[model samples]
Target chain A: MRFTSESSADGIVTRDFTLDGIPGVLWSPAAGPSRAPLVLMGHGGGNHKHSPAMSGRAALLVRGGGFHVAVIDAPGHGDRPRTAHDEQEIAALYAARAAGRPEGPIVVRYNAHLAEQAVPEHRAVLDALQRLPEIGADGPVGYFGLNMGTAIGVPLVAADPRFTAAVFGLHWPDALAGHARRITVPVQFAMQWDDEHIPREAALALFDAFASKDKTLHANAGRHKELPRFEANDAVPFFVRHLGSAIPGASPALT
Target chain B: MRFTSESSADGIVTRDFTLDGIPGVLWSPAAGPSRAPLVLMGHGGGNHKHSPAMSGRAALLVRGGGFHVAVIDAPGHGDRPRTAHDEQEIAALYAARAAGRPEGPIVVRYNAHLAEQAVPEHRAVLDALQRLPEIGADGPVGYFGLNMGTAIGVPLVAADPRFTAAVFGLHWPDALAGHARRITVPVQFAMQWDDEHIPREAALALFDAFASKDKTLHANAGRHKELPRFEANDAVPFFVRHLGSAIPGASPALT
Candidate 1:
């Protein structure tokens, strides 16, 4: 489940690759051929390759922290096409949820439908990482997610134990409440102090319930978008300590 | 021609008016009507209300510094159409100047074109400011600019001399080389140490050439985009000192 990447101290090079016939983007710093650690970054809802948060983080990792970063679009996001449920159907689904019309089978079906659309794309990105020439067979890998990515990425880490560390920002407990026991890797949870969307207490409890050997909680003074500043400074060091040496291309010094 | 504007410590119910016509966006802590000292903000190139730099500066002014900030777009930029020459024609004009073609008539024509297209809109914004009921006749006013705004704002300050103080980031000396004598108000010139578009030495020379009775030069450690971090701590204090008390609706206490 773990993968290696290659990078250098100056700047990272982003190369396009196809995974399981699905196109994806890979990032690594410009360095002599050398194995380096990798961090898999997942974007938030309705985001794609050019999302500011993801691109900013990737730039920070390459220039500030000197880490190799990879990013991909999720299903029904980015350039992907809409599923059987277009905007109207999706609105109806949410309306149904809001109106307290409990259709258990329908909820399950919708969840499965989303997963069916997304999991393949996720696997494609992961599989492409394994096939990268520079990543090698034994390099360390980490996962970082924001919002919806937290929901999708946690299960990916659980299914594959090779992910040595993870960081989740602005995540609620219910997204992965039942799967906490499955995540054995070191994890860090970053939350906003006054987030309107996610209840702060519930988010803390979810991080606390995780059965990882090592877990840490962090908070920022600002709301959801501003949380990245704390991560820019804190998360890089945590990844370096847990995942391995700073990835040559992943260091912040380059930025 | 120095103008002053004052509001309560809460920064609501501003008192100074210089230009007339534009309505200020008002916010107060209390439910009732209030006013504060006005902070006039000018945006850079090709930006409008949705611009991140303008919005970020406005947010920082409101949240970090506790000030009432107003941002307006300039002419031929942001919600304004280009009624004049396209890029090729503009390039030809520059080429004509470089080739020492007839300069006086071309300069006059160019200025006339801009005056017709850009100046009226800017004057309209200023005119709007002159009519705010909360702003006093002699209340303090602070002006700040970035990039192209810096280019245009210098002439405005020179001609009007109403701004109590101002901050200019990323200025071009060639554009304002002749107007230094007109700038008698206290001013701060912030130049990036590593700005690629504008050389640091030239910026310093421009600041030195200014005729302000009181002025300070701040050297930030970042490029043009990162200048906000330098202002993160000092901007509020500088504005408060020059622009009088904070407004009631957008006070620092909210942060």
Candidate 2:
């Protein structure tokens, strides 16, 4: 998708817009009159559009590959109002649920319910992307999500089938597997061995379930926060293989 | 040296001052109503107050140890003006003095001159610190410099013996040794294995020249940019031992 060339001298432009009726911030690089492929990115839980992880990746893609990227605040993050009580109250609620609980069915049920409530907000963001003028209809479109974003994005891509390629970093297998069978586009999955939230087995299983014509999985060396920068070095090739023509200086390997 | 409790929250205040009569920015964190320990921090080449490497260390000291910290601009860097036309001009001028083959003699002469020009700026900052009412007469003072800061600070600290402790990260041994023997305060030296600027042997020789009754050396696992944060985690204890009480919950091994 081609972005308009009105970005600041630093090649970045910041704007506020409504996506599926949810207000959020968008950051895109200046691409002049030329059209560039668009990559829709989602941040991890409790992170906002200006999150270091998201902004860092945006910088790499903009400077390293000249791709137009956009990131939106997820529900209850950034400017979004918290639908629940204050942070302390929420922490206490979660603490109580974990107190004396075994690590099995009960915890799984509670998490599943939370995940269900979050899906619609994520879908809204994806749907809103379809309406943005900056995102051209004729070019390749990619989606990238990490952790919580991955949870929402995998299912959204599975249910919608419009994305040309998708990459999920440090995510769970069960949630991803359910949607993986439905993805027809190229998919890249990164599994972090030291992740605190997701198990390695589940990550591997999700990678195994992807029935996409082209799929790649990388077992990385750091914790979740360090994975994005690590994957950026690996992602250039993946993007070039599937969306090479749409991105400037796209290469088969990270230089 | 006890600073007033109120002053620590207000930050260190400075009087109007000039370096070579050139206006400069000066700042100090209010250590407290009672006298508290102080640290003089020097930024790396091409770096200033807001540089991530410098600011991150300041944050750690303030948040992790509650120490008062001060940082200053050096000659030809940040707010400081170049004595020569430009970097290339300066290099060329030095090159000509060394018979068009600028080698060790040329570099030593060039940096030594730069160090001379920077002394007054460093002193002006120290003068401002001494005038702070909150910093009382008894609180200990320390000095730490990173990269180029070490080049200038080693001479600055050695020539003036008021500091109670000093630390250098990424330093040139032969150049620094001129002042290293004069440092009576407890000293700490940290070096990165892969430092591109200061070779390992030079750093080691510099560390060995210190005649302080108490000395410590830390060989870290990363490059120059990563060394500060890693050393900051350990340097606090060194400061606590020679300066005052350890920061609460800080490990004793840090010293």
Candidate 3:
């Protein structure tokens, strides 16, 4: 576990770090004490730890809500080394999309492929976070992610008991629906009503499959890429309500 | 080759026989000549060769259009012997459906397991049909099926050149999507626009993935079961147009 860079602005501190080669960013209230509630954010496909949506959400969680936020680039994505297999797979995807071919199979296949590696890789990161002195040995954890995030989160969260809450995004041809029953944590799943890539029925079916007693579906009428903004408002409160009790060091700047 | 029962009524001749332990039904113009065009039909899941829908459509096709149709029991379905594996799989499926679990994975996994034998079983039936003198040595062949049919048909049709055209029903949960481009025969893919069991976008994507230049989508506003009746009208003409050039042996009685 190592911190490579740290910057502060508007009372929010952002730190760039890597744990055993997993590149990540952490955002926290600049004045918060050691050990704060942490939210791990998963980015969409073709995106990295510092994508606009990921960084912005990280900032919002820490700067406005006085919580801690963490994000890591999914394997084969930002800061992570690529391989010939990844390059060939991505080239085929671009060709399919450019030809106006069926997008579901292409995306579904890619998400499924990414998920095989992302889930275990994420667990490693979570294990690393547990060892960080700044995160507080017993800090409560939540997850925020969509698309590629859910592809990875669906399996990771189902297996990991550390997270108390999660906000899942997109519906990635629904590769992760099979794990829905195993995700016992309180969840807020969000999706666009007309996701161009995933069928609406599959999305609804995915939400219905979740066995979580406290799961809620937040659907908005928009395209896939525009969904995060609509979900950000509710996500904060859900996490804060579930994880806030442990964050006794709420930044005085926000208070 | 021996017909167990043959009945001629409603201008249709329906025959029941066992082909090497595979029970099947054949419908043809009551007075058609020995040689006629053939359209191999595939039935939905949990349905048999003589199921009301199967027999009804077979009757309608032959009676209404003077064509010959064939349907064989998919392995472990209809008259085929069910193994312990089949029973165990069915028990699990019932539990999943009863608990409202994600049907996609359960069904996809079951169908894939079945296809390991079902595809070859279907091809074996086609091989037997070739030995029957009544179907004619020169008769062109086509395929019609949906649901379990499409799951098996997608792969069989992609490899079998004996079929000149096909009408695939149900959105094959996409385990077979990888073979979409191999199906170069003219295809009339049918699906219910709001099928309770199928995602429409996946259906559209499947249609788009087909390499066949002559593929068409025959969509209707109904559920999975409601789709076949609407498609029968177009399916008959489509098959006849593609396979009829050689079936000039018109059964004078029907005309």
Candidate 4:
């Protein structure tokens, strides 16, 4: 992992880095200890690693909670070049939608494989993140990802035992169900009641499958894309309670 | 599952059905025994359960090989209604391609979730197919799903032990790798050398991941969409040899 650029603003130090060709960003609180706890944020599908939703949550952790935050684009997403299949599929999906037709098997087939690859890729990123001295090698860690991130994070948290706390949002059940059984970390899962994408029953099924001793389901009234703002409110506190109390919520005095 | 429409042509009985809400089709050779071998043919992404490619294979097995064939649409596809999210994402993907910009994160996130869901959807269709008397409860079974179908087929074949043989085409590595390990059945995997979609290395990785003792890799020269014509020529014989001897390639005598 190589740190390519670093800058500081308003007590937050942000740096962009590359790990084995995967580009990502890290945000740290300036006055925090060199060994502060860290959190990994994941963006939703069709969005980059530092999508506004992901970046906003990272900002909350850095400014409100004095923790280090990290995020990376899943393969063929964000700064990475998408594949020809991907390009064609997306175009077709759009055409179908524009023509008021269903995308059919295209979206599911396209997403499932990427989700499968993203989980291991997230672990690879975690392997590299542990080497950063600013975040401390042995500090407790947390994860927060939704939709595509949830698909990626669920398998990742299940496979890796390092995450002490996690927030999985906007995801539904399938192959990820069995993996949920292996996760023992404290978890906060978010869902939208009127989610245009995910089925309500599937979301409930996924939440029920988590083997975590302590897990909370945060259900809000909105669509899938409208979830991030509502998420940051609960997510900050969820991470603070499990990882540490160093971080504030939106309020500075909360910490 | 409700069999909505049943039709007979050229001594082949083709039935259209909807399992719960998922639309599907079953092709059965009229003269075969009640428990003749059953093979499921899956369609590619952006195509319905009975796309010309899928239907042609079904017709071959039923007429040329004297077997039963089944297929279904992936969620948000086929007769199913596409979601607002699916349309928006596809449109965005197309715009990116049209502008010569990479699709990046959009494709990965969109596909990861869909791929995860499609496998089970395929399984559900399989479950429905088994209940039909035309195929019977305990007949030999094989699978053939390429591209999007391959994505769904890999996981379905891994989870279900009922399959004795399979033909996976137009696929690549990642999620399918681990799933491939559980498949100990006789398998035939196909690819294209100059394919416009899947990466050659990724396809090789998927082929290598299979734990099957008998597996053959067929690499031809063509684009992604042109695979069905080449595949039908070989896959028909493969299923016949492994599952049972009933299919004769494109012979008027058999039909």
Candidate 5:
């Protein structure tokens, strides 16, 4: 693991790093306990590691729950180079969307392919991240992702025992439900009740597949892209509840 | 409205009152603005206005959101006298429970019948409560109820325009779907994914029937009676978001 750059603003310190050539970013409180729990976030399919969604949620986790948050670019996302296969899949996805056809089949197929490579890369990143002096190996870790993020997260959390909690949503069950069944950690899943792309039944099925005894499904009334922003705020407490806040008295007032 | 008893404890003032022979209780912040928003709550079947769920949630609204909370006993509940009809329905419900039959049908039929009477009573109480100097008629009001409360709240909120937001769940939609369609206020609904009494499809159907442009469903992994306690805490922010807190900067940190 090698850090390329660092910056600080608004009580949060941001560090950019690369491990095995995979670009990643870590966000932490500028001033707090030296060792805090870490939350690994996976960005959406077309988005990079530091997309607004990732940074926004990272801010919430860091400021609200006083936790460290990190995100890494997927194989063909962010600053990474894409293979011919990745190019073909992206073209197919765009073609489906442009033709007003179902995007689920193409997205499911493409994301599953990416997950095959991304999961092992994520484990390696975790191994490297845990070695940092500020983030010891034994601290609780959580996963937060939605849409394509959920697509990759199900299999990752299922295979990785170090993850203690997860927040996932907005994806179909086609390629993920089987892995979801293997996940036993507490989960907070979000979905669009009237999502145009994913059928409501499919979303429910994925939530139903989680083996966790302490799982909560948050279904908001909206189209696929119209997921209410408050869901992001809601996830902070879920992590606080399951992972336990490392910063003393840092429990947030949900806005 | 007439107050029969009053007590102050734990930063909340509790007042027992009656309007035209109906018994009810009101909870409010001991110190804050002279006037605050109000939330009307409904208790479950076989439960009274002062059940633990009622007082517990009242504490949340009063201390967390700085709102006044009120709940009145449905006809044949709490301090009220039961009619022969109420007695018969209670007996039938008990028999079904003892026989290990599904309780949905009995609970639905009985609660719907009770709601017919309770709706008008709730309106009258709201009118009298608003007449108080502290809770003017113009202040925003919200409704919070589950189980039989949802049964009563769906119609009550549908019929009353004064209510700006509501939290409802845990009832079959057989008798309430039509009313739910009429409610356009923002809503936060809760249900058990594995509820023994209500089918999963039934719960989803009720949530789908809501016409609110902004609504959310929180489905936890548990049976009918095992709803996590944090949901009550979650409702405070929902009310605060919609009604606008009156207690200047008194946002309670979520535990």
Candidate 6:
């Protein structure tokens, strides 16, 4: 793992890095204990590692939980180069959206393909991240993602034993239910009650598939893109509960 | 309303009061603004105003949100006298439990009957409580109740326009769907995913019936009696979000 550049603002430190050419970013409190829990975030399909959603949530984790948060560019996302298949899938997704057709099938298929490659990449990244001096090998880790992030996260979290907790939502179960069934860690899943793209039953089905004995479904009343901002603040407590904060009483109730 | 007794402990002031012939309890922050928002809570069947759930949540609202919370003994509940019909219903509910039968039907019927009587009683208590100097007539009010509370709260919140937000769940939709459809305030509903008495669909249908534009469903993986304690803490933020806190930045993220 190699950090290419580093910057600090608002008591949070942002460091850009790469491992095996997979670009990523890590956000941590500028002033806190040397070591803290780590949360791995997956950005949406069309978004990159530094997207506003990722940075905004990272700030919440950094300031609220005093946890280190990291996000890597998925294959063909962020600053990564896309293969011909990736280009074809992107075109198909755009076509579906432009034609006012349901984007579920295309997004599911495309994200599944990306997950096949991204999961191993994430595992490798985790291995390297754990080796960092500030994030020792035995600390707790969490996964937070939604939409396309959930598509990739369902499988990724299922295969990764290091992840102790996860927050996922906004995706269909067609391609993820089997993976969800294998996941036993605590989970907090979010979905839109009136989601435009995903059927309500499909969203509920995915939440039901999680084998975790401790799971929560937070369904808000809104369209797909209208997930309330407070949901981001809500995730802080979930992670803090499952993964103990390194600094006592440091977890801010960002709500 | 006339205060019968008063006491202070753990930063909360507890006051026992009565309106007409109905008994109730009020909990408030021991030190805060003279007048804060109020939350009216309904207790489950077979329980009273001072049930652990009621006092526990009252502590949260008072300390976490700087709000005054009141709970009245429902007709035939708490300190109130039970009529022969209440006795019959209680016997039926106990019989159902002993026979390993579903308690949904019996509890539903009994709670509905109680609600018919309790709704007007609660409304009168609210009117009386608002007359107090500490609880003015114009402050926002929220309703919180689960199980039997949901049964009663569904109709009560629907009929009252003074309530600006509510937290309800863990009840069947059969008798409450019509009333739920009339509530348009923000809501936070909770349900145990594995509740033995209420089917998941029934719990969900009741939540769906609410016409509130801003509503959230929190379904946790647990049995009927195993709702995680964090849910009580979760309610603090929901109330804080909808009903503005009286003391600036005094709302504690009790999570």
The two-chain DockQ for each candidate, comma-separated, is 0.01, 0.01, 0.01, 0.01, 0.56, 0.55
**lDDT measured at residue A223 in model 5 versus the true structure, 0 to 100:** 98
Q: Please provide, for model 6 over A1-255, each residue's C-alpha lDDT reduced to its tens digit, 9 standing for 90 to 100.
A: 999999999999999999999999999888878889899999998999999999999988887788999999999988999999999999998999899999999999999999999999989999999999788899999999998889889899999899999999999999999999999999999999999999999999999999999999999999999999889988988998899775665524322
lDDT of 5 by residue, A45-164 (tens): 899998999998998899878899999999899899999999999999889899999999999999999999999999999999999878889989999999888988999999999999
Residue A107's lDDT within candidate 2 is: 29
Q: For model 6, how does the per-residue alpha-carbon lDDT over B1-255 read when each residue is reduced to its tens digit?
A: 789999999889999998888999999888888898999999988889989999989987887788999999988988888899999989998999999998989988889998999889889988988998898999999999988898899899999999999999889999999999999999999999999888999999999999999999999998999888888889988999888876666524322
What DockQ does candidate 6 have relative to the true complex?
A: 0.55
TM-score (0 to 1) of chain B, per candidate? Answer: 0.71, 0.76, 0.89, 0.88, 0.97, 0.96
Model 1: share of real contacts kept: 0.00
Weakest ten-residue segment in model 2 chain B by summed lDDT:
B1-10
What tens-digit string does per-residue lDDT give for candidate 1 at B66-93? Answer: 4556665455555555554735445665
Q: What lDDT is reached at residue B157 by model 1?
A: 69
Off by over 4 Å in 1: A1-10, A86-117, A222-228, A246-255, B1-255
- Per-prediction TM-score: 0.44, 0.44, 0.49, 0.47, 0.96, 0.97
lDDT of each: 0.59, 0.62, 0.74, 0.73, 0.92, 0.91
**Residue B223 lDDT, candidate 1, scale 0-100:** 60
**Per-residue lDDT of model 4, residues A1-255, tens digit only:** 898999988777888998878899998887756577889888776889667777677877776566789999887789988989778878987897788764434555566678787777778888788887766667889998877778788878888888999988677677678888888897778776566667766776787688875665655445666653534744665676678755433332121
Model 3: residues with Cα > 4 Å off, grouped in runs: A245-255, B1-255
- Give the DockQ-based CAPRI class for model 2: incorrect
Q: How well is candidate 2 docked (DockQ)?
A: 0.01
> Residue by residue across A1-255, what tens digits does model 1's lDDT show?
232333333366766554544445666767634666778887776577557777667766554445678877666667667676745446665787688764333433443455445655675566667666767556778888867667677667777756878887566665466666688787777666556556656665676566775565554334555553435444565676676655445422211
CAPRI-style quality class for the chain A–B interface of candidate 1: incorrect
Candidate 6's C-alpha runs over 4 A off are A250-255, B250-255
Ranked by DockQ, the better of candidates 2 and 6 is 6
TM-score of chain A of each: 0.79, 0.78, 0.91, 0.90, 0.97, 0.97
| RMSD (Å) of each candidate, 1 decimal | 23.5, 17.0, 21.1, 24.9, 1.9, 1.8
- iRMSD of all candidate structures: 16.6, 17.9, 25.7, 29.0, 4.8, 4.5
